[model samples]
Target: MSETLLQLRNVGKRFGDHVVLKDINLDIAKGEVVCVIGPSGSGKSTLLRCINFIAPPEEGEVIFEGRTWKRFHSAFNFIANRKYEAKLPTLRAEIGMVFQHFNVFPHMTAIENVVLGLTKVRGNTRNVAREIAERSLRQVGLGDKLDQYPEKLSGGQKQRVAIARALALNPKVMLFDEVTSALDPELVTGILDEMRRLASDGMTMVVVTHEMNFAFQVATRIVFMDAGRIVTIGTPEEIRNTTEPRARAFLSSILG
Candidate 1:
């Protein structure tokens, strides 16, 4: 496998006339944990979406594990590009996403939720899926909650189940979009702790979060964004001690 797990060059996204991301460039290496931070509407989440092609970029290219996709001109000239359609599913399978809201099925047990993707998407047998689900749940500390439904699980536990669902696929990269934002303050650390464990186990992760503590502690690199562009990219210590005015102000506003 390539050491460079994912790369984006000059990626851009727009909604009608409004630009959500512009000239964004990023590289995520294997086993790296990168935390992205910025104020609302700063393109933090949009960058991750572009990485997974959930919302493909309008310009530039995305290269993942040696496969490449480029944006091109269309007859309508509307930022439309149609390339790599066949490989998209395979690309997406290697990159997993966990949303802020725990989007678990109301009727399914924790194990069942984790196994759905394995059986449905990956074509695994029920027995095989259950084994993977059980192991994944254990990884997230939800072993005891396997048979419990989402409604019976706490916010943190539900989020763990969601994480387990993603883990069952064994994605090469995990994208977490503010996974702790909707949880109760007390439950937030549980999810953060799970993330920390994953990082220690060498999972490559791109996390868009407001949890500065988690970012400071676990991130191999921190990316600061503003106005749809990355303003600063550094290690935790470099970011904390940055003298750049915009970076300083943003850090002070959040850290202090």
Candidate 2:
């Protein structure tokens, strides 16, 4: 365990009349891996979105690195709204997120795809950005594919390129939203191994995953959510042995 790097305080979210997150409170420590699990529609993905203000929460506060942000509502004051929007790029950069899809540009080479953000948002010189991009691709075992386009790479390789793009930004925390769900079964291992290496290197990660074995083995803590609320939070052993009915049902359904 390390110092708390991100905090969600009494967070809640809704889409129309239906609630997606209910007073969700969580603390993510630096150098820790926290696996968020439960059935689909349990707000796992929404939770990640809220953390990075993708779809900001409807209620409560998010505190990252000591800066506090309240729920983002459309009806809020215009000045506050503009300020919120202004901070998003920097916020999102520190909180790198990868999605279920690779989302790489088909026309760009892997390195070029990674360099896009570095040059645009970060304002790095092209040569400096390229060097950083090259190192990041190499970090993800994709040094040889720097010139390859998304259409020319396998699903896993494309995912690696996406990951390299994130790493090039040097984010403080990484949010993985079902990153391996779309990959072929055989290709999944390579991505999982990359994540494992990140965990071993002490990168703080919040992962929404259905991979029970990886959750059990790698997580410093596990969060079990159900029907828009966190039903349990504990180390893998505590969660695995939880008596909470909703959590037990989820674990049995998935892990059995």
Candidate 3:
């Protein structure tokens, strides 16, 4: 069996008085594609953000690559926890993320956008960055659109560029938060196809998506969340044949 690449131990999150994620625990093995499915405002995105420390959990340990990063008790302690903060750069570099919105820089060409991280974060030379960026873009089937700016590309193309940008970082795991949600219906399949290709290549991925068909085919495990907690987690076959009342009702509503 593959090793656990990432884990959330009793993770919790809140916004003022509103609780979002509650005591969420999950384990993502190497090369495992775990899809998180839930209705709107179920904290799927928040969970991913916590993994990347974009939204640090108020109470929990984010164990990635065997290192445990914990939340500080007080706001002042949060910043004072330099030991944990010091690891953020390396952790962020090792875990790539793609959001629902294609956040490519508008002025930069697709190639330029992909090269930014290699040059800026990893500090690779511009020439070396371009070489790696070219390969990454090609991997996403965007070699011909290398010079195209975001404004010139379709919604699907823009998302591909985002994926390629993340790929260039050579992350250990990839987190995708509803990456196809903003695309047109026809464009959704293209993005999902690219994702399937990534999974085929043994890329460990954690995706939060609503497309049940894509989830059924791509996910090694399906996690159903509701009211700030995981309701059920099972294999695609088990999920499809579940008898649990809450799981059945939720699946019926979404898949029907």
Candidate 4:
């Protein structure tokens, strides 16, 4: 048991009368790679969002590095709301999130896009930001494409730039939301390779992915979710041998 870096206790969320996640409890330890996998509508992506407060869990505590977020009040009473807002900047700074689409700015070059977070969020000087951005881009194998605009880059390159933008922030844990789904088939391998490398380097990661092979190869543990709840948590081999019906059926569908 490594030290827990993030904890979600009894997390729950809903939109109108529809429940997306319910009583979800999970703990991620430092340097662990956890891959979340499930059928569409299983709330895998929403789980990641809740963890970062993008769409906060309506009922739960998001504890990161030992700090707890105030309980959510729908109307967000002033003092409680202010407390949440007050911590957003610092909390978000420690969580790096890469989305399904390449969310890079079209107008900015790769290096500039990566530098933006460093300068704006972390308050680094331009020269300092640039150096950090350059290093991050190079880390994701985009060194030669640093000055290229989004329009000039391939889908794979654009995704790398998005990754560099997140990496430049030096987050405690990286959240990947179906990162390779938007890429063309040929480009998926490159992105997965970079992720595998990240796992090998002991960067804590929580990934929502449909790529079973990648999950098998890189995940320290696999979380199987169904109908807004965690069906089971297991290592790749355990998942493959699971007796739980939903998980068994899901794997059969994927493996077959």
TM-score of every candidate relative to the true structure: 0.92, 0.96, 0.95, 0.96
Superposing all C-alpha atoms, what RMSD in Å does each candidate have to the true structure? 2.9, 1.4, 1.6, 1.4
**Model 2 lDDT tens row, 152-202:** 999999999989888889899999999999999999989999999999998
lDDT of all predictions:
0.90, 0.92, 0.92, 0.92
Clashing residue pairs in candidate 1 are none
For residues 1-256, write the lDDT of model 1, one tens digit per residue.
3389899999999999999999988898999999999888899988998888888889888998888876444676443333445557777888889988988888999999988999987989999999999999998888888999899988989899999999899899999999999999999988999899899999999999999999999999999999999999999999999887888998899888
- Please give the lDDT score at residue 46 for candidate 3: 94
Point out where model 2 deviates above 4 Å.
74-80
Sliding window of 10 residues with minimal summed lDDT for model 3: 71-80
Q: List the residue pairs that clash in candidate 3.
A: none
**How large an RMSD does model 3 have?**
1.6
In the range 182-201, model 3's lDDT, one tens digit per residue, is 99999999899999999999
Q: Is candidate 1 or candidate 3 better by lDDT?
A: 3
Of 2 and 3, the candidate ahead on TM-score is: 2
| Residue 135 CA displacement from its true place in model 1, Å | 1.3
Q: Alpha carbon lDDT of residue 159, candidate 1? A: 93
Q: What TM-score does model 4 achieve against the real structure?
A: 0.96
The lowest-lDDT stretch of 10 consecutive residues in candidate 2 is 68-77
